[model samples]
Target: MKVGLYFGTFNPIHTGHLIIANHMAEYSGLDQIWMVVTPHNPLKKKSTLLEDHHRLQMVFLATEDYPKLKPSDVEFRLPQPNYTVNTLAHLQEKFPTHEFSLIMGEDNLNSLHKWKNYDVLLQNHHIYVYPRISTDKLNPEFENHPKIHMIDAPVVEISSTFIRNGVKEGKNVQPLLPHKVWQYIEHNLFYKK
Candidate 1:
């Protein structure tokens, strides 16, 4: 099986995420797209994040209807500040029958050189890049890499940060998130200042 891993905190999984995953599975060669719930992203600040479990639950709620999209808790058991290369290595070891590909936005691509062990990641793994505003393509470090595939999906600028801010300001997030997820967020009062 060919699985595309779309790793993120997913503090509250939104419609934009679902749309992108659906598009990838429908159009791309990937058999599955796992929305890997990162316990903690090394590159991001932790102060604004909700509990990891809550984030994972939101991801579960948002993606439950899509068979091709899975909410992965792989990073929950791994060491803190999860690194892409480390998770990929562990996933490959555990699921040797499957081929795992990295799914990321163009913004991440521009900063590919800064990721931990990025060299190994580019050399060994396949990457699927989706366009994001204000971000350029991957630099020459991956220029010769045959495994990289670029995709153009509809860019919805809705982010977890925006959702959180909306909730905090008591704004309606019904349009941004799935119904169940929005209910969960409101019930728990997550991100409310």
Candidate 2:
């Protein structure tokens, strides 16, 4: 199967995330879109991110209704602060038959050079880049790269940080999140200081 790995912290999975994932799953050649919940580094325990499992649960709640979108916790078992290349290698070892690709936004594509072992990642896997409301300049090298496919997807600007801040300030951020995910966040009183 052709799978697209969409990595994110997913602190509270929001509607914008679903729109992009669903777009990739339905319009692109990908057979499945896995919202890989990026686990928090144990070394950085005091970080602002929610617990890894909680974020993963939010992803599960958000994606449960979509057949093509699924949640993954592959990073949770890996060593802390793992790189994308390492995850790709591990996934390759775990699922030898499946063709795995990356699903990222335009902003991420611009900073791809800073990633560890990025050369290996570009050579081994394809990248599906979706539009983002980024003011950052694009890297010239990947402008016409064969491994990169620029998807004409909608530009979603809603961010998890925005939702978190809104919730903390007692604003109505419910519309930004998936119904079940919002319920889960509300029930847990997450981000409410």
Candidate 3:
């Protein structure tokens, strides 16, 4: 089975995420799109993040209706300050029968050169790129790279940050989140800081 690893903190999984993941699952020729909930990033403010399990549960609620979309806690067990290459390697090892590819935005593609062991990543798996609204052009090196597949997916402008801020301000962000996910956040008073 082919899977597209859609990694995100999903601080709270919102609709924009679903739009992109659903697009990949339906159009990217991948059988499944795993929404990999990332552990706390050492570089980011840890206080702003929900607990790993909370974030993972929100992802589960968000993706429950989509058969091809799955919520993954694969990174939650890895050491902190994780790298994509490490997660990919671990997933590969644990699911030897599954061929995994990355589902990333075009803007991320522009900075792929900076990721740890990215050359090794390119050599081992295909990257499914979805469009992002960004001023930066995709790096010239990967423009024609066989390992990079530009998927003509929608440019979803909604972001988890936007949803969080909106919720904090008492804005009705319910429409921005999946129903169950929004209910969970509302019930828990998450992001209402």
The most accurate candidate by TM-score is: 2
After TM-score superposition, what is the CA distance of residue 74 in candidate 3 from its true location, in Å? Answer: 0.6
The TM-scores of all predictions, comma-separated, are 0.92, 0.97, 0.96
CA lDDT, every model vs. true structure: 0.87, 0.93, 0.92
- Superposing all C-alpha atoms, what RMSD in Å does each candidate have to the true structure? 2.0, 1.0, 1.2
Model 2 lDDT per residue over 66-174, tens place? 9999999999989877999999999999999999999999999999999998899999999999998877778998999999999999989899999989999999998
lDDT of 3 by residue, 14-100 (tens): 899999999999998999999999887767877769988999999998888899999999987898788899999998999999999
Pick out the ten consecutive residues of candidate 1 with the lowest summed lDDT.
135-144
Candidate 1's error at 110, in angstroms? Answer: 1.0
Backbone clashes (count) for model 3:
0
Candidate 1 positional error at 86, Å:
0.9
| Number of clashing residue pairs, candidate 2 | 0
Q: Which parts of model 1 are misplaced by more than 4 Å?
A: 41-46, 135-138
Best-to-worst lDDT order:
2, 3, 1
Instruction: Judge candidate 2 against the unseen true structure and give its global Cα lDDT, from 0 to 1.
Output: 0.93
